[model samples]
Structure formats: structure tokens, C-alpha cells
Target: MKNSVFFVLVNILLCACGASANAPSEAEVFSSAHTTPNVLMIVIDDLGWSDVGYNQTTDLLETPNIDALAQQSLSFDNAYAGAANCAPSRAVLMSGQYGPRHGVYTVSPSARGNAKARKLIPIKNQRGLKTQVITMGEALKSAGYATGTFGKWHLGADPDKQGFDKNVAGSHQGMTFHYFSPYNLPNIKDGPKGEYLTDRLTTEVINWIKTPKDSPFFAYLPYYTVHTPLQAPEQVIEKYRKKGIKGEDAKYAAMVELMDTNVGRILTMLQAEGLSDDTLVIFTSDNGGYRTTSFPTPIRAGKGSYYEGGLRVPLLISWPGKIKPGLDHTPVINADFYPTLLTLGKAEQPNQALDGVDLTDLLLNQQAINSRDLFWHFPVYLQAHHARTDQGQDPLFRTRPGSAIRSGDWKLIQYFENNEFELYNLANDLAENNNLASQKPNKVAELKAKLKAWQQQTGADIPTELNPEYDADINQKMIDKILAKKTHH
Candidate 1:
């Protein structure tokens, strides 16, 4: 009997050992079938939905390279920037959180425009991202990836401290003082005399990619092209001039073409390096185009306003054979890229809560995510660039302190100053010409509740105190002067 018991114990031990040997390790479970994929994220400053050739919205500007990329990418038709301007939009992309969470509603002091024009005291803005916030660079670096940021890093003074292995010219400066060499920007030594900023940055990225490294890389190329100080190579400028595009229009066109050419260069480098198939390339804009230079028509307003033109931007994601090339109509925001990238890199989530959903299944298997409301809270004021042509609610300012919510086809904008609401069904009115707030009271109530709840949940500060300097008469005079100038022009 004792011998029989010994044999049974031996058999049980052998079975347990076999099971343990066959189990997959933790790393194996997290890894892909092949080595990890490299990520190349390109963010253009103030690039509009209608700017690219794929959209076919304008014939004045040419973007052959961007158009070609669109052909090989899963272009999103309803993609939005996290905010209507540069700093906040970039903050959202980096931290994967909404404006309320980071307190970066707009650039610098939120109380923009003349003191008399502002009705309420706007919420103060956070200049740069806090060190405590874990950026995409930090997350990807933790996952054993070599990270680099090549151009504009407007979030902070030093991207190196924010988790980047290499930061070329990233700084707190929003716009470049000079587009050519003797650029005089931080972290970038001046190149050859008369070297174009866009071209130089592209070369820097290509050189970085060529450097030998064991782990996969995350290359963030945020070009400061097509922003302000609308400058371009004289030759490119003359090319547009020859096409009969004159004035700032010609210069803007030249800048767009230059940016597109640099994009082509990057694509060529990726192909030459044999990294095309192994890399995931995402091209998008920080925000919508500026109204004074570029026209974001058929979708009212531009840049600072919360209209479709202000928030909407071109988004293209390409992973060669991994993701099928086609148009995706799903409404997505730039904040979504954070979780999506972390999942692709097989990285652990940060301790802080992320507002975006993981889009792995949607990208790889074409499985659509469940419908949910997207929110935007901007408790700040942005002065108008061109009050006459800006297509905003009013001519005085582009946007007042407000919060907006989009649920399915319905969208509602709530103004903090007057407690007014503007509701529109985006499916029917993409231009947002019609305000259906009074027409649909129930819909307004439904969306308002959700917006309020979101504000409460995120601890979004609303501007309530009336501005002490606000003058009704002065505000009217300013409006009249703007109108008269428009008429004179």
C-alpha cells in the first residue's frame, strides 16, 4: 500500500511540472508575433481639414506627398484636435487628458482681447505641462523604446525632463522667430546660412532614425511650419506667384507645399531605411488653420472658435500591412492616440486616469467602438484674428468662455457668461448655421445635464465673476469700428 501511494505522488509531481513548463511567460504574452513596431507621429501646427489634397477642398494649394500618404493610410473624416489652438491641443496629445484636467485652456492669460470686450473674468491658464503629468514620451520610454521629439515641443521648457531621450528644438516658444538659419531658438544650433527650418528639421529626424539602436523608437516630428511669420523659400514662393497666387496667399501656398515636400522626404527615408513595413506612421494637425491666411470654408470659423472648422483636423494613420488603408468615418479625437499607442507598444498604463479609449481592436480588426459623447471645455477668451471674416458667434472675439459636447449627431455649446445654449445636429448642419436649441428643448436639457456632470467630474472651473472693466459703450464702439473697417475693405 505504501509503494502504491509513492507512485501516485510521483505521477502528480510530473503532471504539475509539465503544466508549468508549457505556460507562457509575462513578456511573451505582452509581445507581438514579431519584434515591436516603431512609431512615427507627425503633428502639423494649424493644419486644417481642408488643407490637404486628399480632402480636395481647395485648388490653390498642392500637397501631393500628403495626398499620397492619405491613399496608403486609414484617413479619419471626423477627427478633432483636443482644443482649438496650439498649446492646449498639444497638452491633450501629450497627457491624454482634457483641458479641464490640465488647466491649459488657451495660451497665456485666458482674459484675451480688450478689457471692455470681455464679459467675465476667464479662468487662468497653465503655461506648461506639470512635471507630475506622465507624457507619452514617459510611457513609451518605460516600455523600453528609444524616444525622440524633433520639432516644436510647446508643452514645457525641456522635453528631456518630460521623458524624451532626445529633444532637437522643443521649447516653450510657440512660434518660430525665423524660419531660416540664425533661427535663434533654444536647443537648436544654427545650421548652414539660409537653411529652411522645415527642411533642416526633416534632415535631423532622418539622421536620428538612421542611428543604430537595439529597441524600437518613438519619433515625434512636430513641425512648426505653416504657423505664423508666413515665410518660405523665395523659389517656392515664386513658384506659387507664377501660378497667379499673390500676396500672403502665395506665401501661405508656398509654406504648405514646403511642408508637404518635407513630409515626402520623411516617407522616402522610412522606405529607404526598410522601416516602412515595420513602422506605424500617424500624420495629423495640432489644430485648425488660421482664418486670415488659410480658409476653412464650408465649416464656419477657424482656429479659436469651437465650431467644426476650429476643432476639426486631418488625421491619417498608416501601418503598411498591419492596418488596411481606407477612410474611417468614426469620430475620433487626438487624445485617443495616447491609449492606442500605449497598447501598440505593449506598455503599462500610467497611474493617472486616461480620458481616451483604447482603439487597438478598431485599428487592427475594423471593429468599431461603442458610441460615446465627446466633450470640450474651454473657460477662456480668445481675441479674433480677423473680426470681419472670422465667422464666429460675434465679431469682437472668436470664442467666449464655454463648454461644448457632441453626442452622436447632436452637439450643444453652453456659454458661461449668458447661460445660453446653441445646439446643432452635425449630421444635418456641418456648417452650424442653424441653432436648434429652442426647437429641441428636450435635447438641450439632455445634453446640458451631461455637460454639467462632466464639468463636475473633471473639476472644470467656470467663469462666473463679471469683469470689473467691462464697458458696454466701449464694446459697442469696438464692434462698430471692426464693422466699418470690413465695409471699407
Candidate 2:
């Protein structure tokens, strides 16, 4: 959570990332006995549903290994990230509660848009995870598990302080300077010249798993790949460019392919080490793709937007002998992972209050959770990427200060700025192309009442203080500038 503008070292140390490292092998090793299930939660950064073959197949992108893994996994049809952006989503996943509990609505201060364009003064955001709250690593470490976090941590400096035994590259910084050496990242040392950050991190994981340990390990591989400052191998970039992909699309696709390659490496290592069957591999992303790089269709706008495109993400859970393999449409969010993993690992539940329910039943037995309503609270303003092209309610921002909930087939969103509600029956309109709030007043009332009650119960903050500098004329002028740009294009 960077409260101020982040700075990075301009010069890279120039080191080999991991080209000479031992190539992956198909050799399978064995052990005497398996006591408990190991957890391998792979949280990829800023990936969308349509980016992978499992969610939406296209020759435009190739993710054969992930697709194969999906075939052997219980893939979710309606999976969601905790928040519409990065840090808050990770916070929700780690804490197992909504924004109200953790107060990490977005990275840094929540008031993102220009002051004149904003109507309300956003709720102040916490820059780091508090020590009072129990983290996932801390909970699992207490349960006698060897916990290691190998990539971007974002929350704070030194995950070791938060109960991790081994942290290869994790700290207070959110994104690396560039995806290369001399990253200017805190707590991570630079490798050899021309080393790719993704490959280096993958090698680190491989080495970690190779070490024979007594307790079942919790490998939290939160890759910084598929994120910004997009950098990849020249050959990989050339491969996608040959397919008619160019500019940001090609660079982004190359990085995605590289990420999938590294993921395949990890999966292969588990199988080779005879750890596949006993390990539960949970795969998902923090949120959707950034609007600038790549965005898949049928869902609405990209990452910052609150529509399905930003919230809905790809989720896959695979445990060879324990869980079944197939598709499941049980609606789920990132918070569910904390309680679900605690229960599955036979760990003690924390004393503090948790908003998510234990989902071990759903994970192992394929049971559906259709009754509980999943919610998201973002009492902040997120400016739109491209007001003309980006799918957002108003032109100023992708999402204004708002709270949203999805219960069964209906999903309702309440924007605090205008006290306006937008309702959609997802069963019929998955894209949320139609707003049924005006049409079905009764349905709107029912869901709105529930949302309001839940907010009060959770002590959710609603931004009400007017931004004294707010000017309607200035906001309209900004909107007009975008409109004018679009017309010219």
C-alpha cells in the first residue's frame, strides 16, 4: 500500500535471472507417509477470465498446460476476486473478511480522482495490514505448517514478521520497478544480468519445494507476473508478434504465456516430487486485467470497473485423490479461501470475527453454496482508464464510492454518491447489460434493504462528507474532454 508516489532505481544490476538453472524433469520421487494435505495457493496478479484457455479458448492466446490442469481440476464457472483492484483483494483473501473489517478499500488513499471531479471525501485507507489481525500465513504456521511466501506481498515489509518461514521476494512495495533485476524492491536481492523476475521467482519456488521438510508446507506463490511494467523474453515476445499481436497486447500476452510456463514448472515439480496428490493447488488471480494491456469480452470493462469483467476471475482447485475434477458454478470470492483452507488443513479458527464461511464442504465434496450472499465494499473513487471506451456508469470514474452484493441470481450495486441502485438478474443477463432496478421495484427494494442492513451490521463506511473543492462544471469539462477525444478518434 504505497501512500505516496513510489520510486525505483533507474539502473538494473544486470544479472542472469535463471537460464542456467536445472530444467524441469519428469522424475517422480517418493516418501514414507503423508500426514496432512499441503496447500499450494497460486495467486496470479491481474489476470482475467478470458486470458486463459480454461475460461475462454482462443487461438489468440495459448495456455495449454493451464487448460490441461483445468481438465483435472474443479474449475469454477462463477469465481470472483475479493475486490475490483489489487491490494484490497489480497487483504480480503488474507483476512477472510470484507473491506469494512480490514479497511483496505484500495491501494493508498481512496480519493483517486481529481478533487474537483469527486463529490465525496473518501474514507481514509490503511497503508498496511495491522498486527492485531491474524494473517493466513500466521494461522497456518501456528498449525505446524512450513509457510513460505515467494512473490509480491504488497501489505508490508518483512512477511517473516507476519509468520512466514521463508520469503524470497516480498515486502511493502506493491509492484516491482520493471520485471527485471535491480527491481529496487525491498527485501529482494538482484540476480545475474538479464534475469527475468518471473523465471527467478519460479526457480525459487522449485528450490523451496525440493527441500525435504517434516511438516506439510503452505506454498503461497503470489506471482508478480501478468502485472504492469510488462517485460518478457525477446523470443516469447516475437512469438506472439508473429501471430499478428502487436503493441501492449503482444507484450502482455508474452508475459502471460511466460507466467503459464512458470506455473507449469511448479506443477511438474509437485508431480515429480510425489507431492501432487497430497497438495491442494488453489489457482486464481487478484483481480481482472488492466484496461491498457488486454481485456476479454462478454464481461464489462477491465480491472478498475466493478462489472463482471473486473470482479469475475478464473478459479481452479486440484487435489488428486481428495477432490473431484470438473466444472462447478458455485459463486465464490477471495475471502472464502482463508476459512476454507483453515478448515481443510485442520487448523484452529481465529478468535476474531470473520465474514466468510468455511468452504471445505464445497472444496472437497463439490457442494454448492447458493444461499449465502457474497459482497464487495469500495467506498472510494477509481478513475476510468478510457472514459469513452471503458464500461462505467459515469464518465469520470470506473466506479464511484459504492457497495455491491450478489445473492442467488440477482446482483445489486448501490452508489453512495447519488444513492442510486443498479440491479441485474444474472441468470438472464450475465453481462449486466440490463439494469432491472427501475423495472422491478420490488426486487430492487428487497436486495437494497438486504445490502443496507448488511452494511450496517458489518459497520461498512459510507463516504458522505462533501469534497469542498468539488465542482460540477469541472467534472463535466473532464467528461467532455474524453467525449471530444473519442469523436476525433
RMSD of each: 9.0, 11.6
Error of 2 at 427 (Å): 1.8
lDDT by residue for model 2 (347-453), tens: 89997777877766666655566478889999999887777767788777988999999989899999998899999888988778999889999988988889989
Residue-wise lDDT of candidate 1 within 306-412, one digit each (tens)? 99989999999987656777899899998999999999899999988688888777776677998988889999999988888788887888898999998998999
Q: Count the backbone clashes (under 3 Å) in each candidate.
A: 0, 6
Model 1 lDDT at residue 198 = 97
lDDT of each: 0.89, 0.82
Each prediction's TM-score versus the true structure? 0.92, 0.91
C-alpha-based local distance difference test score of model 2: 0.82
